[model samples]
Target: MQDFVAGARSAFLRLASHSASDSARSLWADPSGVRGVLRHRLAGPTSAIAFCVLLGAAALGVGNAAVFLGLAGFVAAQVLIARVLQHLGHRLRPDVGFRVVVVTWPIALGALGAAGWTAVNDYHGEVVSLIGLITAGLVALVEPTGFAIVWAVVAAAAVTTGAAVGGSVTGEALVSTGAIAVGAAFGERLRHVIEAFLGNRRELLEETARIPASRDPFQTAERLLQPLVRWTPVKNPSLVWFTPDGRSVFLAVAGNNLPPHLAAGRELPEARNAYMRRQAEQGPWTSGWTVVDGDEGYTRGVASLGIQAGAYVPLVHEGRLLGLLTAGWSAAGGDHSAMAEYIPALVEVAHAAATALGPGLAELEQRSTASQVVDDVLHGQRYWPVYQPIRRLRDSTLVGFEALTRFDAPVTTQRLFIQAGLVGRLRDLEIATMRAAVMEARHLPEDCWLSANASPGLLVDTDLLASILEPIRQPVIIELSEHEVITDYKPIAAALGRLGPRRSLAVDDAGAGFASLRHILEVRPAHVKLDLGLVQGVATDLTRTALVAGFVRFAHDAEFELVAEGIETQEDLDALTRLGVGLGQGYLLGRPERASAAASNENAPRGGRAMGASRVRSRTARTRSQAGAIAASRTTTPAH
Candidate 1:
């Protein structure tokens, strides 16, 4: 069963075994193979030296050969220590399918000493050669490459000792040590090459398996990571999907360390390699691996036992990269070959997982779209206006229209719009809509102005102004909403500063909030539109009447026009006129008419004391005249 398990079509095992064996023979049959198996070949002179020391020690204590063997053992022990140091430095694991062979130098040396003492006590000359051979074999097991060095050292030591102390030089001993070192070196070299070939072949087979099984790239990453986690603990198991632009974004279905910016519109880090190699779109997926050791047990905790070693496998499905799968060994206790052996399997699983996650990916995209829609709305994407006419207070002559927003698409919920913090967008939208309505209005009175709502944000949104200016050439009245009073008003003020001298501003819904009243005083608008709630019952309430009359008087004193909205009764009109209000707009004055009708009234009537209508027209005319003056000033200003 062991043999079957060892040989059962595993390219890794076969390759490793073959490469080791080949490395042993490469020195003789193919020197180039020596380089391939240099790490494993034991072709060195240390073995020969070990042999020489053993014989010398044996001769010195002819009556106690065991003591000599003990000395030889000490030298062998040193060599094993060297081999261990090399292993730790390289982080290479023991050969695959095998346990870590830790031939401790202390134990081996002790054995050598005991054996030599026994040989001397037995007066056995053969024991001398035996010591040389045992040391050679031990060194071979530890580091096949060290064999030559071991053999050469042992041979010289043994020959010298035999000649000087024993008064005899055994050609056989010299020959044996030499032969073993050379043979082991070549054999291990050959073995190493075959192992590599077999390993590559096994990987090809695994890749093929992955091709059919790839269903969900992300899940495959999880599956690939599972065994790694079991073997080596990781703080977080996350995958990065690299883009061609060197950006590596996380495919974070199972990890918590991902950054929020990644989910927004930020691309992955540019250092990601899959993008550079264009392997993100290729199969036999180019796998990129990187390992990080965090401070204070971040990646080195008790939970992460097998993660001392890490491997990353790139996930590619049908030439498209799904992401990357990384797994590590938490503790320092695994074979390097075993670690390498697992990489192919991980790559396959990642491919499978990515392919399977199609439905989830689609859902994620939908959510992304919804989020974008909300953002675009808030930023005023494609928002614009349509115009409705306002009658003149005195002549009811062709007057400007109230610019209103007609959403291209039905936006049913005002709550949704406001909650999105997009009221600013609506203001800009209203402005654009007004500009468009005026530009398209068939015969807008040449001297009339368009009244449009404005949010404080519009002043700061230079881009929004740029858009409107590209298509608009008429005077514009920017009506400030009550809420705009509290928002950052500087940008709006700055924007207003840029408006042609002729443009004017108004405070809309003036009495609804004290904020609006303050804004009107600060902005010094050409007009103030009293809130419908404030104006509707003004005729009946004396206190309200007194307050409104005060506002009307204030408007006149401040050289500002007053317009009343929502006049439903004759009493409302009569009271407003009595209050000295100028412009009146509501059912009594006339419903808001289309732009075309408002522009071409040849016999427009003169209404009586309609404070709101008069206020609106007066503001409009003043705004247009101001805009014309500003344009004239600009034409005359000296160019920088």
Candidate 2:
């Protein structure tokens, strides 16, 4: 019985809340709203005028023009005054008192009765009951539900009593009183139905006018949360966005005073771990406020910031938790508790913000993950650079070495560069790799130039340019690839010029694109390395042979040494030698190797073999007579 009673009581509270919501949305109090547009009880005065004339005529007859004229004149004057008041109300800013008109409705009823009494004879009790029916119906259209019911009761009893006091010699007043009372009850319900329609229309217009764009969803969500922030005394308000992996969450937006510990990124507060667990198991608290501990336990680390407590509202979509919208306060804990009545409204606002922020969060999460990957690579201690020998084809000598970076992750070379650039860490990675390559020079044979690759943007960077000026045992060759476009030649040329005579610049992948050729002409480097595309099948493919032949001629005339890369087979080597290429590097010549002690000690066969034999492979290269023949042919061959 208690449970049933509690359910019944809860239901009644909902009904009352809903009715109050309807009335508040109705805008009857707002002079610039629908009620204002309708001029508040719009048809009430006009209908009152029509009733007064009819009642006065029925009692006095047309021949009694004196009393009838007075009634008609009074009705006209009231109509004019109502119109004037409506116009003034619209013209003013603070709005005229529209609610005052609801009270005047009873006066209109009394006036109608007076008009009947002044004109009539012997229909006393009958006149009172007639006024009751008209007043009830008219008040339904003119006033809100509560006012309509009260006016109906007052008009019925007042008119009936006045007739009896006049001693019209009729006992009919008793019977007619019941008729007036019943009309009041029905009239109130009729007013509520009419008000509900108007209320719905007002709410629809309000929402449509406020929200215009969702292009910047985070900003839009913040703007949407402002109303709730003002209503609640929150010191900190934030919308947290979950990452794709769900391992981390970034503060999409922060409003007001944010807790120092919470900052901008969070997966979940450790303090709320228990709170969330209970909510997950028992279902969340559907209503009321949850007080966050603001005492020493909560305030421990952030003691200086003085955050007393917090309130978190879950942002749920389709039963999945997307994020939390939180509010922090430095005030009394009971402040948020006092706002328990507004919890549902505040939650509704959180729902709207979370919805707008969904797509925005998705985009941020992907970018944030990419940034995290870059940071992990730099600080992870899992990545290192290895050397691949660049051999001189004439003597098969290890003339130079190019550093190739490797990571434990399976990400491709292109993806690594792209992901690093996404986080603005590409230069940092490039500098790290270049430094590693320079360190390898200590383990290498003397006179072997250490070649390191860099993008065009990194070449002009001050730190990299400064690093290029550092003294080394051998010539340092900087190879900028053709994959990136050289946007400005002047700065790269200027920065490279500062490296002095010991440094050499090589335009890598010369046959890859026009940009590499541009790099050769504008920067006028010491060497040009032909791309794998031209060198891969040069012995068989005529077009590849022609392209390499053209690059060889260009390199010679431009006073730059030519190198052909990707020479995996003997045929490719012979072909490149025939093409007058002096240098090459590929897996066939020497695999990239790590020079660590552990690699050799563990007897990791393939890894150790590569490390120990990296220099021996360069020594084992059989001097090709074809390479000398290619040089002879290059001096003799015609344009073909």
Highest lDDT against the true fold, candidate = 2
Q: In model 2, where do residues sit more than 4 Å from their true spots?
A: 1-221, 227-238, 243-268, 273-285, 292-322, 325-380, 393-397, 409-417, 455-458, 461-471, 483-486, 511-514, 537-549, 569-575, 595-640
lDDT of each residue in 1-640, candidate 2, tens digit only: 1222222222222223334444234233433232332342444444463555458547644445554454465556455545655555345321222333333433443443455554442444454455444655554454546755675666556555655655443323432343334334434444454355335434533452365436455665566555545444554566655445634343543453545555555345544544544453342222223434753343453333444555566766655566666555563542332222233444565666666666656555556676777677678844666666777775566677677766644354456667777667787777776676566546665567777787777677756555643645777788888877767799988877766677778888887778888888899999888887788778899988888888788878899998777666666776787678878876556556664431232222221123355444433332332242233212110000
Give RMSD (Å) of candidate 2 vs. truth.
Answer: 15.3
Off by over 4 Å in 1: 1-385, 394-398, 413-435, 460-474, 485-497, 600-640
TM per candidate comes to 0.38, 0.54
Query: What TM-score, to 2 decimals, does candidate 1 have?
Result: 0.38
> What C-alpha lDDT values do all the predictions have?
0.49, 0.55
Residue 506, candidate 1: Cα error in Å is 1.0
Error of 2 at 492 (Å): 1.5
State each candidate's clash count: 120, 1
Error of 2 at 520 (Å): 3.0
